[model samples]
Target: MNKNLIIGQFTDAYLPITDGVVLTVKNYAHWIEKKYGKCIVICPSFPKFIDEDNFDIIRFFSIPMPLRPPYRMGIHYLDLKAIKRVEKIPFHIVHAHSPFSAGLFALETARKRKVPIVATFHTKYYDDFKSATKSDFLARIGVDIIVKFYEKVDQVWTVNSSTAKTLKEYGFKKEIEIIPNGTDIIPPENLEEYKEKINKIYNLSQDDNVFLYVGQLILHKNIKMLIESLYYLKMKGFSFKFLIVGTGKDEKYLKDLVRKLKLDKEVIFVGRIIDRELLKGFYARADLFLFPSLYDASPLVLQEAFALSCPSLLIKGSNASEGIIDGYNGFLSENNAISYANMIEKLIKNKPLLREVGKNAQKTLYRPWEKVIDEVVERYKELIFTYKKNF
Candidate 1:
């Protein structure tokens, strides 16, 4: 809560383009200003997106990625213009939310200012790159870039041990602190009304079992397997509403898969829901959260689901499924469509068990943002003091 400690955080994405990385930067920036000192957010500038918060922000010019239009890539260089802008902010620490373009900018500023830098390994870039390009060679290049990016940082943090192991496997030798992402949402006061709204809009009866997947509609999230699982369910004559929220580069591919599988009636692609109340409403309407991503490190979606008492159904040993006990907080399946189909079919039959597990999921939501961000800020404090002492 020291006002003297100024921090500059860098991220590649922000609002109007929601993901874990963007949400992480926003939440930390918002809470850091509320408690610690001022936190300045440096992100890519997109057209028509204005600075809409009380926090300090510096946006650099960025353009939409050709392959992935939803993503805006920063075009900042370490020239006089970049240096001039970074020099304006007197920050004690430089925190990079990603290890890409904005991260490189943060590294440059930290090097120029002789300040400590920290980075959070938010995603499995190898999988992300592979999904984007469908090329292992490019994914290897991405792994190399990630390795080199973290080499210059003073401290590294992540959300789970599986991802920490993945980082080590990718040639990063530094120690990584595992700070699980927190979920902070004020549940809609009228939950039943929200449910009714969603049911009416989606053309579903209140008796239908709603299964939800609430993140990017991409390959690495195992969305293809989810779609296949739905096909298997339909074959078995199961009746349920599968809600596909959020959009990504693979929207067309996933949609085509749904059509090919003839799941047009069961699956509903709601696109990206930016409104928090509507999002929370969809979360409340669902009976289960179906997420079976193998390449993740404690996805915030799981926490969001848990916060709303919506138990997640994920694959065993998947990073996002960590801490989720099978049949307790969530149901764990194998890395196959048949297994997911079996789990969904079984859970659909036992509605009482679904509610019971959902109740158990709430047990994992007691950790407040106040505690999570305190640990994060404490690390910033330690890294800064250590940097000053060593220098």
Candidate 2:
């Protein structure tokens, strides 16, 4: 895979900015072009996205990050059409996902072509700058600019080990690979026909349930205590259904706090789905997957709700409650809104313990996407054979 390798990816977000670091940089340029190679992303300037055909983006000058909406901020000057498109593509590695402004433009363009770069510290960016600049001295200067960008990355990833102990308590003295993030969401051997077609498209009657909550309704994704815990599970009467897919900037302050706690007919804001076979039939017709984020570090929608079997409840020490063990397989909460309305009113009065923890979280928690892109192409061939045997 190194022979034709051209890999390069930098990112202050991309593609109309849809998060999870633009779906992990388009699944690392779609499995690094099915292992043959050639990537090149470099991001930020999205004046209405255009380029679309197996990675090769590159835009530059950006701006609007005031109280962040779709997070713009990518202005590290020096353009010259991004230095003649990285001087006609020679990069062998320069991954980075964001240590701010495309990790200082891939460390000033891989220090003028000496190449060899790597980074993937996904989130908890100092608790996202103390919830977007509420300032603890600006989240300690964004954790001293991510410990000087993980001391100019040569290696540093984190998908678990509770985010490598929050990147060594945010000083990151390098060496931190964990790498576990992948989801194509495949768990459908006729799961009750996607729970009777999501209970006849959300009208619900087959003993109504659904409690979903895909991601980003903002407020650091605690999502205003998950819409005030559905107004305390609709004042405990609990006639289920809370489905809030996605779309951010806190949609009109969480739809005016569900009409000021009236919970407007047991909350239902089914916004963004992005059709992955109808978002895997709303994660196989969810029965509970709330996710009360206290600042995530490793959450790709909790492995797309454990690849469609949906069992998430997570909150006990966020980072998606690493390998959850609350009630086992999943269900942890304790972050708030009366502890996520007492864990969704005790799994809505235990529907057979939420279908035996969603069938042990999809047959005992899974992981694929070609074994997480084969540990990112064997850490990109051991960082391109130790950067060409020390240059």
Maximum-lDDT candidate: 1
Would you list the C-alpha lDDT of every candidate in the order shown? 0.84, 0.78
Which of the numbered candidates is closest to the native, going by highest TM-score? 1
Q: Could you tell me the TM-score of candidate 1? A: 0.94
* TM-scores for the candidates: 0.94, 0.36
Q: How would you encode candidate 2's per-residue C-alpha lDDT over 42-122 as one tens digit per residue?
A: 887877668775767788888788777777888757556875776678887788888887887887777788878888888
lDDT score at residue 387, model 1, on the 0-100 scale: 91
The residue-by-residue lDDT of candidate 1 on 204-283, one tens digit each, is: 88899899999987777889998999899999988888999998888999999999999998899998887777887787
Alpha-carbon RMSD to native, per candidate: 1.9, 17.6
